[model samples]
Target: MLTRKLGNTGYEVGAVGLGCMGMSWAYQESSRDDDRSVDVIRAALDLGVGFLDTADIYGDGHNERLVGRAIAGRRSEVVLATKAGLVVDDLPTKAMHRDGSPAHIAAAVDESLRRLGTDVIDLYYLHRIDPAVPLAETWGAMAELVRAGKVRHLGMSEVSVAEAEQAHRIHPVAAIQSELSLWTRDALGGVDTAVAGPAAAGAGQAGSGDVVRWCADNGAAFVPFAPLGRGFLTGTLHSATFEGSDFRAGSPRFQRDALAANLRIVDVIRAVADRLDATPAQVAIAWVLAQGGHVIPVPGTKNTRYLRENAAAVDVVLTEADLAALADAPPATGSRY
Candidate 1:
């Protein structure tokens, strides 16, 4: 596996890393079964997964606690990353809000460090830009973390190019994480350089207008959080596979009517899978990888079977023909929340 540096910082990680969010929360109401997920983490390490992505808001920080426990004896082998800035509840079980105040950031990192059982987080991100707070002030807090040696690099999630430049003026951003996929190509244009785009879908978002290229041009890392589009592109949610509060159930794209219409897009992936003898998941991941070396997709999964399949995506090669065919597939799906 290849490695890419975090921002302009010396910190480097495997090109394909694990996003540990699903192991704890979102996608469904769930929790890990013993060390089953930890076993998968260990396996990833053996396969050279030097990078691990987590967030303070995930399971109200339980995911960080779990990741801390999993990497307790193995900390030196990981490039650990996490985010704050979401004004989440202190109760640890409530839905949250956003707070990008400098004081909040200063307070957040210590809690993150304590939960991760680490002194310094390799990459620290502002989970979301708090419109109530000035980005410069928020970034100043992050720079303070860098100064205090509590964080090695600063990052922003779902921000814009203008905001990225402003934050970069305050401090060098290590990575920008946003939604980027075959369908969510807006980030491909430029949103990846700063934060994820299309804000009305959510907060602090923008169009995909070449953000990844800007990051590549600047030697900064571009991390795509939902690279698999919540398993839609993986051919897992074919028909009636989603049930209960499976996150996707609430997404407009996956609702019965939209999903029935979206299945046609899967046929496009299926065509490539049949010809290339590769799984749709592999094709999706490989295309993300093919976008740029600095572009890393943290595809989340609780299933060990899917974990291994996503990991193998690092080895899958997408030729120009394959890229062209997939790119030409009229992005049939709607916004993925």
Candidate 2:
């Protein structure tokens, strides 16, 4: 795998990092095997997909513990990143709310550290801003973690450029992780991309500005979560019917009519993939990589086969025609909740 600098952290991680959320949360819950997930994480490290991302809200700390177990003996080989701010309300329903209050953030870091089994975290992100709590107080708490040596760098997820600027003044925003893929380009700006669901009230509003450009200009890495459009751009999903527990089952874009309409976006990706002799997944990830050199897309997968496929996306270069086609692909139908 090719490497890219992780913001100004002075650390170069694989251009394609691993998102460990689905292993323990938000996906096929019935098939979630901790042992298999551990193997996949270890395999990721072997493939140099060493920038591992997780969050305390995932599985209500189960995901962090699983990641801790996976990297038990080989922590040095990974650039571990985890998050705080969002608290899981109901594990079964995956309901959650933001708790960016300084007190919550203060307690969350120690809990995350203990679960991750690390003295210090390489990168820590504020999963979502709690509208109830002031961003300054929440961010200031995170900056304190950096000073206390509990967290190395600070980042934010699903935030506007204005919010990033506000937090950056308090502490350097090493990265900003948001939903960015061939279909969802909200992070690039010029779209009404407010996040939906429990934290929707606190989600960044539309016209958040060009966050991708903001990161580039401000010396921060743009980390795109769900870079494969939550597996829609992979061209592997032909049905809108998902298991009740699956996150996609309830997502608007994954609903029947919307999904049928969204197939046009996948068609464009598949066409580009066919031309390049690559899988739609690879083409989708490659398009995200094309957004900027500082952009790193973390397409989550619990399967090692898919992990290898995603890791290989770094080499799937897009041509001018491919870029144009992907850029002109129809906007995704339905909200990104």
Candidate 3:
């Protein structure tokens, strides 16, 4: 596996990291197996996919516990990262709200540490900036955690460039995680504001520039979450037959008519994949990797095979022709949310 520097944190992690969201929450809830997820995480580490990402909101802390258990004995070999700030309101519905207050940050860090079974978190991200709370106050509290040695680095997820600058002024923004798939290019300067959560609030707004480039200029790593377009870019999601508990069931893009139209984008991707002898998932992940050296894509999966396949994307190199075709690929038919 290829390795990349994680911002200025001085930690070199695998280019393709692991997102543990689906193993405990969001997608295919019925098929989730804790034992299998644990194996997958351990296997990820063995493959040099040492960067692990999870959040407290995921399964209401279930993901963190699972990750903690998986890396219990092999903690030194991994770069552990997790998030806070998003409060789960209704577990069944996956309804949640943001809470970025200092008090919330103070309490959440301790809880995340306990759940993760680690004394110091390598990277702690504010999952979503609470619109109700000022960004500085929340960021200032996170910096305090770093100073106190509870957190090694600070990160912001789903934030605009301006928001990042504000927080960076208070404390260096080590990393910025956003949705940056071929379809979701808002992180690279596209103007699709219908993204999920607080990330959408800054699209097309003043001071919110190309966040990916901003990270590179500021010496911060840009982590792309959902680089697979929630498995749609993999060319395996042909039908609109998602389970009730699956988040895609209610997503606009997964609706029957929209999904059929969205297949055109997948067609272009598959064509590129075929030419390069790579899977559509690999092409999708590789495209994100090409965005910048400071860019890292965390494609989530609970299956070990998919994990290996995704990590192999580091070997998939896209030519200029392939890049042009993908850049011209049809815009997504539905909103990212």
- Candidate 3 off by > 4 Å: 195-208
Candidate 3, position 53, lDDT: 95
RMSD of 2: 1.3
Model 1 RMSD in Å is: 3.1
lDDT of each: 0.78, 0.90, 0.90
TM-score of 1: 0.92
lDDT digits (tens) for residues 217-328 of candidate 2: 9999999999998899899888998888898898889999999999999999999999999999999999999999999988899899999999999889898988998889
Clashing pairs in 2: none
lDDT of 3 by residue, 1-337 (tens): 8899999999999999999999998899999999999999999999999999999989999999999999999999999999988888878888777799999999999999999999999999989887788888899999999999999999988778888989999999999998889888888887754544443332223234699999999999999999999999999998999888898898889999999999999999999999999999999999999999999899999999999999999999999999999999998888767
Cα shift from native, residue 169, model 1 (Å): 1.1
**Model 2 poorest 10 in a row by lDDT:** 196-205
Q: Residues 1-337, candidate 1, lDDT per residue (tens digit)?
A: 6776666878777778899987776666555553877877777777778689999888788889988988988999999989998754533233467888988898899999999999999999989888888888889989999999999888888776777878887788778887787666767663322223332323446563567777787678999877887778888776645545465665668777778887777778778878878899888888888888788888887767887888888878787898889888766445555
Q: Could you tell me the lDDT of residue 197 within candidate 2? A: 54
Give lDDT for model 1: 0.78
**After superposition, candidate 1 runs with Cα above 4 Å error:** 89-94, 190-204, 240-244
